[model samples]
Target: MKQSRLPHRFGKERGRNKMDKFMDNPWFVRIVAMALALLLFLSIQDLGNKSEGSRPNGMESNEVETITAVPLEKYYDSENLVVTGMPDTIEVTIEGQRRFVEATKRQRDFTVYVDLSDLSIGNHRVPILYKDFSEKLKVKVEPVYVEVSIQEKVTQEFPVEPEFNNNILAEGFEAEQPIVEPNRVRITGGKETLEKISYVKASIDAKGLIEETIKRDTKVTVLDRDLNKLDVFVDPEYVTVTVPVNNPRKTVPIKIKQVGSPPDGTVIKRMEGDIEEVMIFGWTDNLQSVNEIEVEVDVSEVTKDVELDVPIKRPEGINKITPERVKVKIVTDKAKNAETNLSEVPIESKGLADSLDVEFLSPVDGAVSIKVVGNKDELKKAQEGDFEVFMNMQGLRVGDHEVNLEVKGPKDIKWELSTEKAKVRLKEKGTV
Candidate 1:
């Protein structure tokens, strides 16, 4: 039996029958099934990778983002109470759909703060809170909870001392006491913190080597006894400072001050120093008498030829020196050594009070004998005026006392006193 064809079914029946026949083929069926399965797997993979940021979703950091240095606002009784232990900034993490996350991070229209208006004076552990942001976004902040200290507000005045790095100044220069326009500053903070304030410094700043005077506007800082900075409100937070950096220099030579003796049968052939012109830094008047800078060395332990780095000692009146260390090459050789005895050298008394008169009791002539020992050639160059014998009578009163003998002489030769000390009697100038 044959079926009647439908209207407009001229090619419709043949197309449908051809499609049904094609589906019945095992090879064609397998190919179509494989294509559909592949399409489904691609769709699932695209969805799974959306959060990994592997592909751009037309937004920056589409899935999650971390915002740093977000200011942390504090809400408390600012007028009557002081709070501590809260950080000035926080780290906020925003996580949600790509659109919301990108919007929140870009706009940055959120607040992370702590509210302590309802609390009393004491320490309390409270959770940090946030507000004024998109509700669809999930927010997380580091240090979710904090321990805060609440105390009575107090205000006090602290003297502002100026501080600067004098070491950074130009060579052979000095910085005088810094002068602050207003020497004092007013600070407000917790009672405990105010009481712990130790230093209020107006730090002065300069660029590179400061040769001339420095004048600038700088901020004041409050610190505790341990030099730890304190968080507080300062009135007139800024101040003007003037630092007088002066270059009062004097050119001089270096003098070697030897302390010990050389070994027997060994003579110092020559001592050559690798130093040139030197500078002494100080006030104009203090630099007047500073003719040389002393560098001390010990020759007692020196047996063979060796090099020594001697530190240049700053004079009592000088403020600074150039070439802090001088490298010296010492040459030693075996030669004939001799000793020269200097007798009847008058001893001088220094640092004696003007109202007192000193008289040597044992050595009535106030004279001493010394033995200078060194190379025969070096000893021949020695002179009586080259050495100074003196006794420090700085703290002597109107009574008898024993004083130690000190010497100032050439450094290449070794010298010693016949007696270590001298007996002297001090009397009032007007007394018998």
Candidate 2:
């Protein structure tokens, strides 16, 4: 019995020893601590994920957005009526679910407009309405109401004229009559406005203009008799205006030329041009060559004083000339012999070189006597001043020579020179 009791005691002690060894092992204790820590960390991470995944009850994600300058459409009777005083655009703000708000902002899926179809003529307040947006979005417009005025329609015809700033034109430049295509225009407006209409004109700016014809699409404006601008609708709002501009200008005398001789027994006593001078426009180079405007007159059958209308002949390179026609007066009388002798008809030496000096040797008084024969009436009006006698010394050397003299006078008159040739001597200007 004692031996069996001893063995039992030993076995109990061995078990006890084994339990202590396991509790005292550092690796085992470290492993148990690591496992417990991992479990606690996983539990906290799960709770965090759940909190992030779900939201509180009765809560949702929403966003707010704003859109600016949204255009407003108008619905009204535009044909027979005119509406005014309405905002062209407005601003809208929307607040809704995030997805819906983002979609609304991206697509801008909405409509803003004012409906005036049911409204009648005169002033009225109309509410600005909007539609076509998602139900989840809250829309707000900046201007909730708009004031509009409607007027009756009436039509009237008015002549269209062109207007521009004349002061802005270049110097020495002028504009001719401005031709507006579609000379007339129809204006539709209120009755009172139509009655106030005085003239319709298209305005253009002539600033810095260098073109010959100014062509542009211009807006038409209505004006009252007082020259104040009026508001009205004009059909065919624009018309083409052709303004001819030029810089060539000259004022010159008119010369009369005879086409046919006078009657057999009658002679032209005197021919005169009714218009003293005329204004002409052309290129600068062309204007420099034009000194006078000429017109031809026929006196073949005239036996008395007659007034004739002659068309002015336009020269090449000339654009326009004032006074399309000129009047000519021709006086005629019976042919008769009449002689007029003058003493002061100076003899001019022409074609002399600048370095040469010429002296007349034949005419002692430096003048010649010219005898002209014509009708008594014509000869009475003729004077020595009318005749010019010139001597040609174009190629003469520094020596004495005889130069022939040429006489100029009216075609109907006969002239006689006291001497056909004049004795002239050429010498160096400073030497003699």
User: Could you say which candidate leads in TM-score?
Assistant: 1
lDDT (Cα atoms) of all candidates against the true structure: 0.86, 0.81
Compared to the true structure, candidate 2 yields what TM-score?
A: 0.44
Q: Give the alpha carbon lDDT tens digit for every residue of 288-393 in model 1.
A: 8787777778788777798998888787767678867898888888867689999988889999999999989968889999999887887999999989999999
lDDT of 2 at 323: 86
lDDT value, candidate 2, whole model: 0.81
Clashes of each: 0, 0
True-vs-predicted CA distance for residue 378, candidate 2, Å: 36
**What is the per-residue lDDT of model 2 for residues 265-371, given as tens digits with 9 covering 90 to 100?**
68777888778899987767788999987788888778888988888988887767888888888887777767878766888988899999988788766678888
